[model samples]
Target: MEFRGRQTQKCPRCGGKALINQYKCPDCGLIFAKLDMATNKAASQRYKNREKSAIVFVKKVPIDLKRWKLILYTVLFGLFGAQYFYTKRWWWGLCYILGFTLLSVCVIFNAPLLNIWDGGLISFFGLIVGVYGVCWMFDIFKVCLGKFKIPVSLPKNELNAVILSKEED
Candidate 1:
């Protein structure tokens, strides 16, 4: 028998090699037919249930979050990350607050704005202001476009459940 051209597959659980025409894993005795049933019947059913629930309970923004309010926060207090806080992104809000504070401190200390004329554009003050400005503008743009990614969890209630008896064809 020529073994060189025979097709083979890897065992999922045991990571052992097996011929594609074989029924069970040679090393782990895992039945390929049972594995197929488990994946197709149970796993795919679960994924379909999840997908249906995801579509039914879809919310563009977080709970109690108004689009107008988010836009207002981004326009007015986005430099300090008020919009991020409202969207429940705490770490990002903290970063914005920290950047604003740093900028304020630099201004208080009368730090020079730029060293571009001195052939040293890599200086301190202007970089922080420039980056902060760009981020603030980008956040406002995203808020306006209604495309900001809000991290909110869907309610795990019966309303979001895909009742097996009521499932459609």
Candidate 2:
């Protein structure tokens, strides 16, 4: 009896009295379902446009490292943060490089000097090396398991679109 809370009970498009289950106008063959379909189609088209734009934007920004390549680099050179360098994390890469370099130099050059301190210097060196090895192995696992992601700054909508496009591929 009531359509969309309106008391008139007339088709809004043609002002016809024909109403089928409060959703159709038989005179004009217009249905509320068709309107919903049209709305959905329009929304789909808009999403497609956004996806296209996002793809174009992604093209402009170069992602130098591939997932497999990153994993390989991590396995081979993660102790020196080569993966971080490839991912454009300059600060982390620098820290890893410096840490590994300094630790290696200390272990190599201090071996003779540490002999005077008996096992104290050996234990310290072993601890540092163990920590570094553990970190390197963790990084390798993270990269190989696809848990590591390259950080990129993108607008929210564009980022969604880009992620969607990547998933499609």
lDDT of each: 0.60, 0.56
Count of backbone clashes, every candidate in sequence: 0, 0
Please estimate how well model 2 matches the true structure, expressed as its whole-model Cα lDDT.
0.56
Q: State in Å the error of residue 128, model 2.
A: 2.3
Candidate 2 clashes between residue pairs 3 or more apart in a chain or in different chains: none
Q: What tens digits encode model 2's per-residue C-alpha lDDT throughout 50-109?
A: 533322111111333366677778988898999777765567788788779768867676
Per-residue accuracy of model 1 over 19-105 as CA lDDT, tens digit each: 888877677665544332221222223334553322111124543567899899999999899988876566789989988987786
Cα error of candidate 2 at position 27, Å:
47
